[model samples]
Target: CAISQEELSHARDSLTSAQSALNNIQQQLSTSVALVDDTVVSSHPDVKAAAAQLRQAFLANARSTLVAPVTGYVAKRSVQLGQRIQPGTATMAVIPLDQLWIDANFKETQLGKMRIGQPVEISSDLYGSDVKYSGTIDSLGAGTGSAFALLPAQNATGNWIKIVQRVP
Candidate 1:
């Protein structure tokens, strides 16, 4: 049996092509292994940076939720949907009914008999006169309302009139 000259040349060319392909595959494998050896797993700077960014994103997402410190009914909320709120800003009032006190202002004349620790009866128009609240007079105001007003009356202009001041 004898091989043709054309077939012999073709076989030589095929062997050369196969060897070239094998060299290419080996080079690719070496490059991949070198890349893996050069860089550490999770301790690489880029990897650590990416992980830190992920942790920061998780923390920011967690902080997006607002939790009230006390169990209470929320009221007078000023924040709107999609509003950008600043840090330490009061977005709403958490009015805990259990921990509440009356902040009232009364005429000075009416406070004459009022004293701290005195038993007082309270009522609100919200519930009509049917609901009565019992409490003690916590404290009395030492100053009049005009004295603590934001824009106190500048009485130096002319007329001297006696105004009945209210006490808090």
Candidate 2:
């Protein structure tokens, strides 16, 4: 009976140690799963970072296809197949002839009576006066062309020259 009691006590001790080990393993597993379960898939930092990388890759792939916003005539195309274009590079030009506006330059004095929406008659040498096109003054020039030139006229110089200014 004494030997049986000793063996029973030893078994109890082994059972307690096993239970403690199992509890520790369960705690570790719960902690690992908590990282992925507490938050939504989209809001999780790891998932969000992965989604952003996928979006960046999608944009990089989409750069190969060029989509123009407006429907118009392609005046010129300078892009070649498999050509690498830098940012802000001129690839092509689209000219919408339907929305064309004529830029007419006139003397500064001539713009005094010119108002917006005023009707004007236009005659081109190529089309002749027989094809007189009716047009309206869209906008008046803010300043003379020389004022916005690459090298503007210096009237403040000691040898200043008075000249008639033309505005467009």
Candidate 3:
């Protein structure tokens, strides 16, 4: 009986030790889970990167929907539906008829007395000289058309006379 009691006590001790070890393991697992719970997904580096990518994609999708900067009429359309457009593509033209102002290129010598908001008389070929349109100079162009031409003139070699350019 004494030997059996000793064996039984030894078994109980072993069981207690195993239960304590299990409790410690459970505590460690809970601590790990708590750390995960404390972390916010938005603050996570991977999640934040994904969110930034999503924002860029959303902006790209919004860009696909073309919206005119000003209220205007669609002058021309060159692109078809679902057509892949490249960057700097001339897809369409918008003409603001109400804001349409004629850009007159005047000689550099002619700009001495001219100033912005100066009223001027305009006559078009469509209308005879009898009909004149009164307008004010809205704005002057920064440079001449030749200066901004796609293929600018190479004036280094030829007999280059200093010619005054027109401002539009």
Candidate 4:
């Protein structure tokens, strides 16, 4: 051999180092293969944890969507943006225009001979009185509005006074 003893020794040391690296890699491969089993990928602990996190993310995404029971405009949301509310909280209100009713009050004297299904001409201050809205009288009230007013005049009191009552 033309190589010197020192060079041969150095080459041997390099070869030994390379062999050690290869052995370590091969051992790692064997260990990795042993870790694989008949369990499905989803059944692995790490995969399960990831799947749980994914499910939590999906739930969070679902929570962000406000699905009203009725197909109507969102009248209100009790909670503000990014506000944390407990589950089953009443967070929104919907006013379905399709199912709406107007509570029109009229003087008791005006309801003379009025019956259900009577055509009514309505107007609002929002639009001018010229913009009349035609509607039908659904039903008549049995009592006057003063009877059900929030602050019903204590008529039985000493300061009782005469007041005209309205009806719906």
Which candidate achieves the best TM-score against the true structure? 4
Q: Give the TM-score of candidate 3.
A: 0.46
Better of 1 and 3 by TM-score: 1
CA-lDDT, candidates in order: 0.90, 0.86, 0.88, 0.83
User: Candidate 2 lDDT, tens digit per residue, 86-138?
Assistant: 98999999877567679998988787789999998989999888998787889
Better of 2 and 4 by TM-score: 4
Q: Show how many residue pairs clash in every candidate, following the order shown.
A: 0, 0, 0, 0
lDDT of 1 by residue, 46-94 (tens): 9899999999999988988888888899999999977889898989999
Worst 10 residues of 2 by lDDT: 152-161
- Candidate 2, pairs of clashing residues: none
Q: Model 3 over residues 1-168: C-alpha lDDT tens digits?
A: 257888999999999999999999999999999989889878989999999999999998898998888888997899998789899999999988567778788888888888889998988889789899888888888888788788977878779687888887
RMSD of 3: 12.7
The TM-score of predicted model 1 comes to 0.58
